[model samples]
Every structure is written in C-alpha cells, then in structure tokens.
Target chain A: MEPRPTAVRPPIHLRIADDIRMQIERGELPPGAAIPTLAEISERWSCGMNSARGAVALLRAQGLITSGRGKAPVVRIPPRRVIRSSERHQIEKDLALKPEAERGAIGEAETNLNMSIGAQRFSSQYDQVEAGPELAKVFGVEPTTLMLRRQWEATDPNTELRLSWSVSHIPLDIVKSNPALLDPNNEPWPGGTQHQLSTVGVEIMKMVDEVTARMPTTVEAQLWGLPEGVPLIFCRRISIDGDGRVIETSDADYPADRTELHFVTPLRPWPKRRQA
Target chain B: MEPRPTAVRPPIHLRIADDIRMQIERGELPPGAAIPTLAEISERWSCGMNSARGAVALLRAQGLITSGRGKAPVVRIPPRRVIRSSERHQIEKDLALKPEAERGAIGEAETNLNMSIGAQRFSSQYDQVEAGPELAKVFGVEPTTLMLRRQWEATDPNTELRLSWSVSHIPLDIVKSNPALLDPNNEPWPGGTQHQLSTVGVEIMKMVDEVTARMPTTVEAQLWGLPEGVPLIFCRRISIDGDGRVIETSDADYPADRTELHFVTPLRPWPKRRQA
Candidate 1:
C-alpha cells in the first residue's frame, strides 16, 4: 500500500498574510494604500477566496491594515505618542509666572514637541455631578457635593480613532470663583489645569500621581485601535493646597505601547554629619 | 427607490455576540466555565454557524473568553495585580538587618501576597552580556564590560498569559563578589536586590523610577491577554550607590487596567538655624 501523503503543511492563508506584512514593513504598502480585494488576493496567491479573506483578517488583527464595508483594507499608520512626564509638574508650576506666549510654549497641552499641529479632532464636555465615594475620598469632599467634571478626547478624523483622552474633576465651590471654569468653550485652557485652578485662587502646593495598568475591553480596543496583549496605563493626579486640603483630581488613560511616562524625583542632600 | 428597507439593519452575528456578552456579565457563564460551542450557540441564538463563530471570536478578543483548537471557549478569570511600589526601596533599606522570615515578608516580592502560587508560573533567567552604549552611560562603565542580567516573569500556566514581568541588570564586576549571585537558583533571594548588592560591598544610596504608558502591539497584546483601549505602564528603575555611581537598572511592564503604580516621595524638614 502506498504511504499516505503527508498533509500539505504551509497554510495558504498564513503565506499570503506574511507576504502582505512584509510588503507593509518594506513600505511597498504605504499607509492609506488600498489593500487587494479578496478576489485579487486569491488570484495573486493562487489560493481560495476564504484563504485570501483570512489573510486580510490576520493583517487587520496585527494593526497593519484596516477595512470596512465599502472600503478595501489599508495599511494603518499610528500617530506619534505624546510624552507626559511628572517632571512637568514642577515645570508647569514654575511656568505659571511667565507670560502667556512663554507659558503656552511650555504648556502641558503642547505635547507635540515638534510644534506641528497634526490633523486631529478634539472635543471637551463639561458637567456638574456629585463626586463618587472613591473620588470624594481623594478630594476630601462630601460624596454629595457637586463637582465639575470635564472630559476631553482627541480623535483621528480620517479613521474616527481616539488619539488621547482624559477627565478632570474639581469641586464646584472651588472653581465657582471663576465661572469661566464651568464652560467647555474655555477649554484648551492656557496653562492647563493648574492655571485654571489658579484663576479660582486655588494654589496646588503638591501633586501626587497614582499609576496602574490593565487590559482593555473589546469596545475600548476599537476606540484606541489597540492590539491584543497590550495594557492601558491609568494615572490619577491628585492636587493639594497649602492647608493639605485636596483641591482637584484628574484621571487619564494612555496606551502603554506607544506612550512614555516620565517622573522626576529630586532628593535633598544628606546631612553633613551623616555624609560618609 | 425605497432605500432598500434600510439594508435590513440588524445582523445575526452582532445579536449573538451581544447576547453572549450579556450572559457572561450576568454570571451565567462563570469564570473557567466552558462557553457554548458554535453548533450550540447557533441553535441557542437562532443564528447561522458562521455567525456563531463570529460571536465566539468577538468574546475572545474582548478578553472574556479563551479558546484553543478542538476545545470549547471558556470564560477568562482576571488575575489579581501585584502592587510593587517605590516605597519598597525604603522598606528594604530599613529591613536589611532583620531576620530571614521577617525580611522575606517585607521585601520587594512581598507584593505577591494574595496571589495563588498554583495559578501562576514564575520563571527567572540569568545571563551576562556586554553593557550596551545606553546602559554604559548610566552605569558609568565601558560598553565592553559584562553586566549581569536577570529577567522575571509570572504567567497563568493554563492560558500562558503573562501576569507580571521585569528585567534587572547589574555590572558583573560589582556583583561578582558573591558567586551565588550569579546563579539563577538563588532568585527570590531574601531581602531582594538591595541585599544582593550589599553582599558585593555596594550600598545603594538612592533609587529613581521613570514611568510612562502607550498602546500595545498585536503580539504584546496576546502575550498579556490585553483587551483593546487598554494602555501599558512602563517603568525604568535606576539604583545609585554611596558614591552616586549607578549600580543597577531594571525595567518592568504592567498592564494598566489591572495594575496600579504607586510612588511615595518623602520630604525632609528644613534645617533649623543655630543660635548666634
């Protein structure tokens, strides 16, 4: 009896996907370039249409391409990550005394160091809600006290993909000193949050940042265009005033793979007697 | 020109997926419980086989389910995050002279407190490699000098999912004082890395942690079992000895969704002036 032929091992779908991946990496499939149709892929790879479709799905999962109902898959070009460092805490504190142009140049919102205003859509929402238990504890306020909640998000208009997101909360009584603080139109606030609080006579003497990370949900993944195995960075910034009263709290999420969080900690000199 | 009945808006696939998601959240599908098979799902949801398959795939991508060839998908149980804080630096420094059992309970690895040993697999690899240019500058060593490298990882054995991961590097010449330090078997060393360096006549006077976050790639997402929209927390820790010489550097990654990075910065009181 003739020995059964070994199963033909090289999966056609994987081979096709590899070829496209290589092309993308080599710049043959530049960002925004249309990917081949299922029929075209099948003919090019000499494989079944299902195999071609599978290859396209593989590429999409790898964040190499994107597809929709009427559109062909296209190479995905991710935006540059913005670096928000804890070192900037001190820098922002110092910059508060500077002129508008100077402060704007060194602003926290100026995450783009190259000074290029890339094409991105930004939206800010403002609302007044009672602080939740967790947030109340951080802000040293009653859970029922009204607080101003501001949420901001920037998206890539072409893909409707989120680029950056953050939420800030301040006790209404604290920011009511400057009614402008309650307006979303006043966003992109010059000098950022610190300056906004300053207008209300709140001086943030100290800032503490708590950070953590976790996996994203399916819906979140689509919003951020995140690939599997990547975690999200969660940061909560707590600000305190001169009397050790918690004044403001803000929480933000960042994609871990592309973003870099920097923290600068300065140490005091050891006592002369204790020096070795 | 009837607008084609609005294209029959609803799809069988989305309906099936949403129903399963609701079931999972409602605890009908408990952690580790097998998810319905494509055939079963097709019958239960009154959808086609392909739609059933799509539903399962959606759940897997959301991190709610895990599947393998020939096996039914199962609900995924989220793992508890171990909290490793910068405060461990001061804790270890103060506990150096304490007894073994006491020291072990308070050192760096103590963060694994609530974790089940059987649920997670821990591995450490030790190697000696030449210091790269970037590391050489920080360690004040020549690029040609060998440096000891230790990598630690904790993963879910069944799913092969990473829970925690970190890498530490030290100049070989500095740690060579204790031969046991070169052995991977000596890991989980009592008193942690600080004590290990002490055996080599190195005294860490300061430590710095730099942190950031970004989106994860496809490969990274799978390894960490991350969902979409999640960010990753990146931390690089540098240790400096008495002479302000950089002695060790370690890098760690954390999933932002489930992990929290806490840093405590201690401030010293201002010096009192002597009476004239």
Candidate 2:
C-alpha cells in the first residue's frame, strides 16, 4: 500500500538518515569509518545543523553508527559472532558416555568459542534455592520445593568481559544422590550438564529451546557493556527425559549483536518419490 | 560485585519504575489494568510530579505500559504467543507423501497458528526477480540470474492484524518446468514449499535457520503495529538438497512480544551406558 500523501515527503532528517544508511549498506561507508560531519551533512542535504544532528541521532538509535559527546560518529564495527548450534546437544550427550579423561579434554564452551581454553576464565557456583512460582509451575512442583541452582560464566581473562553467562535449575530430588553434582568444584564437569544428569540415571531425550528478545535493563546493560541499540537474546531450554519429565531448565542471555543461534532440522525422506 | 556507593543510589524515578515493574511481575498489577494515576504515584512514592511522570515514561520505553494523550496509561497486555516449532519440518515432509485429499486438509500456516482456517486471510504473490548480490552469493549464481520470489502473508480476517509474513526465494531454473509452482494461485498448496519442490526432482535434506533480532524501522513497526520496545525476530531458513546445494531460502519475521520460536533437538543415543 502507498504511504499517505502527507507523509510521502518524510521529514528532512529521515531523508538525510536514509541517504547515509543507503551509503553504508552499499559499502561506500565501511565499518569503523567516520560518518559525514554535521557541516558536511548540512551542506549536502541543504539543511540546517539541527537537521544534520537529528540525522546522526537517528542512526545512533538504530545501531548503525556510534558517537560520543564530542567524537565524530562512525559506522558501527559489528562484533564477531560465535555461532551456537543445536548439533552440540548431541555431541555433548555422546561425550557423556565416554571415559571421564576423554570428556575432560574438551569443554563445550571451548568448542563453541573455537578458542584455546587458557584464554578464558571460567567459574561455577552451585546452591540450593526454593523453586519460585514461575519455575514451580514449569516443573509442576510446589513453590517452595528445593531446587538446585547453578550459575556458570566464561569471561575473557584480560578484559573480564563476559563471553557466556547462563543459569541452570534442576529439582534437588533428582540429583541429590550424586555428591559430585552438588559441588561447584565438579564443574567444567567433564561433558557438561548432559553428563551430570547421566550420573543420576536420567537420560535427556529431547531439548526444547524457546527463544525471544528484549532490551536489557539498565544494570544488565552495564554488566554486559552492551552498545546503545543492541538487544539481548533470551533463551530458556527445557530438557525432557524419556518419561516426559522436565529434567532440567537452563536460562541464557546472549548479546544480540554478536550471537547467532543456528538450528538444523533434518527432513524425513520422501517415500517412493514421484518426479514430474 | 557490589555496585559503587555513588552508583548504588539510582535516581528516584528508576526506583519507582522498578517497584511498579515488580508489581507487574508478581501479578499484583495485571495486564490491561490502568496503572496508578500520576497523582497517586506522586503521593505514594513521596516524589514530585515530574519524577512520577518520568517513571511512567520509563515504563513505556521498556514496553511495559501503553499511554495515549488523554487516556490513562495501562499495563501492556501481552499477546498469546503462537509457538512455531522446528519439528514441523519433518511433519510437512511426511505429509507430502500422503494422498492429495489428506494433504488438502492441512495448510502449513494453519497448523502453526493452531487456529481455524476460516479465521485468517492468506495471500501469496509470485514474481521473477533478479538475484541481487546478497542472494546470488547464497545461491552461487550470477547477480543477474532469474530467481522466483514468493511473498506470503496471513492476517486475522476481522482485525487485519498480521498472523504471519514471509518471503521465499528459489532459482527459476530449479522448477521452471513446473508451471503450477510459479503461479501464486496455487498457494496454500497441499503440502508447502517442501512438497512443491518434490514435484521436481529435489528433496530437501536439511534446513538451517539463522536467527537474529533488530529494532524495526518506522515503516515496519507501523506495518506490524508493534509497540515502542518490541523488537522483530528475523529468521532466515536455508534449505539444502541432498547434494548440499542451497535450494531455497525463506525469510520470516516474528514480533518478539507475541511470538516464541521453539527449536527441538533430539540427541543421538549413547553407544553404551557407562555407570558413574
């Protein structure tokens, strides 16, 4: 549908912003390259300084450019993304059945980062907490039921910037017998969570990842050191056992600008294929 | 780590906004209920009117409340999410082998929406377009090569709200002989794009979904009727044939607030059980 006639002539700032955006998309303006100065924009668009400033503000809000109080705006240098693939679910499970020494040789996060393990700092904390109302409903348990909460993080040692952060919850009754599982020291737990559950005789048959996104809260933005316009990708993964019981749930947040979630679905083959 | 003392004291407005947000999360302030009036907020928080107004503005920017000029602000009512599961890939492929009458009973969008077919309006437009540089790289074809573009939209018949919107592209040479495939009139086609490709000699072996998110442009937000803080989920699904050729790629967008993307990953069985 055609836009309203009155809106056809967009405000001068938007027109200016769109021109620069087009230039950026077409590669005339590459990442980390300085954007046109206000004076330059004003002259090119035949507009006032305020209009030029507004154009820059628009680009900043859309995450296309970055500018400090006095620094000139530049095309945003997109962060390198670490692809998190669904295939890892199987790979982790397969490693769970192997010998402990073999499993310890590879950490899931290390494989995901495709980096040397020494470059990152990892930490894990385990505690017992009451299942809150929201998680209680998901597990079909009482609100005050004991649940094991585990927090894990991997950070760049030098910068201390978070590379990964996630929290996991499991019913205490399910893993209390395995002393190793109760202690945070057992983590980097050879084979990850899938293997941890294996010790308690619970085999995770399927995993469902529910994905969504939202703007980070002020504190979260500060913690992650996120850029102005970036959003946080939220994922809640529920692992189901063979008996259809919810074995564990993990909540993770990834910086949207540098994370890509890849899901691969294998289609069933056609039977007695017919060709036209 | 504890926040610095100076940074610890957030402005009064943030504190007020957090209190209201907690109330919403705790279910004391239900969706669609009018938020406290400015006077009530000012009195209860022992703050000035400007602080109260600022609190309300913060909530609106976070997408927690909606306010019109004269009408009172109300807690935003989140829409019921329609879960789109990756499991449907195999299901659609399975249905393609069924009889025409049986295949006719099920439409891909109808199954995904879990709604009666009569409630939504579906449309499809088909046209031949040049494979632009971006898509050409994906398909390993020349930029000027002919590609068939199909755009589909399903909307609520009464509300005219979009239920689903997607665009699919495939090289014309892949299915040129199947004239029915090129016609938009044949859409809502018994089994879906996967089935249509079955008419020719192509069988989709795997589907890869690359997911990301971004704030929609002004035009996109208006088209989707999205609220201020709701981001759009962008998914690009690439279909690969048995020979590992990229056969088709479909791009779809879902509103973050009301749409949840579920990906189910089934892990391979352990070779042999190892007792801890």
Please give, for residues B1-276, the per-residue lDDT of candidate 2 as tens digits.
543344468789888988998898788999999989999999999999999998997787677888666899899999888888898888877877777888889877766774677888888899999999999999999999999999998887655667788999999999998999998888679878877888887889999998988776655666677887677888999999989899999999988888889998876666564554
- Docking quality category of candidate 2 according to DockQ thresholds: medium
Candidate 2, which segments miss by more than 4 Å at Cα?
A1-19, A36-56, A114-116, A273-276, B1-16, B36-55, B114-116, B142-144, B156-161, B273-276
**Model 2 fnat value:** 0.63
**Candidate 2 CA-lDDT value:** 0.85
Task: Compare the candidates by TM-score and give the number of the best one.
Answer: 2
Model 2, position B38, has a per-residue lDDT of 95
Task: Name the candidate that leads on lDDT.
Answer: 2
How well does candidate 2 reproduce the true complex, by DockQ? Answer: 0.55
Candidate 2 lDDT tens digits, A179-238: 889988766788888888888888998889999988766556666777766778899999
True contacts kept of each: 0.35, 0.63
Poorest lDDT segment (10 consecutive residues) of candidate 1 chain B:
B267-276
Q: What is the TM-score of chain A alone in each candidate?
A: 0.69, 0.92
lDDT of 1 by residue, B145-246 (tens): 899999998887666778778999899988897999999998678878866776776767777787866455555666797764355677898887768888
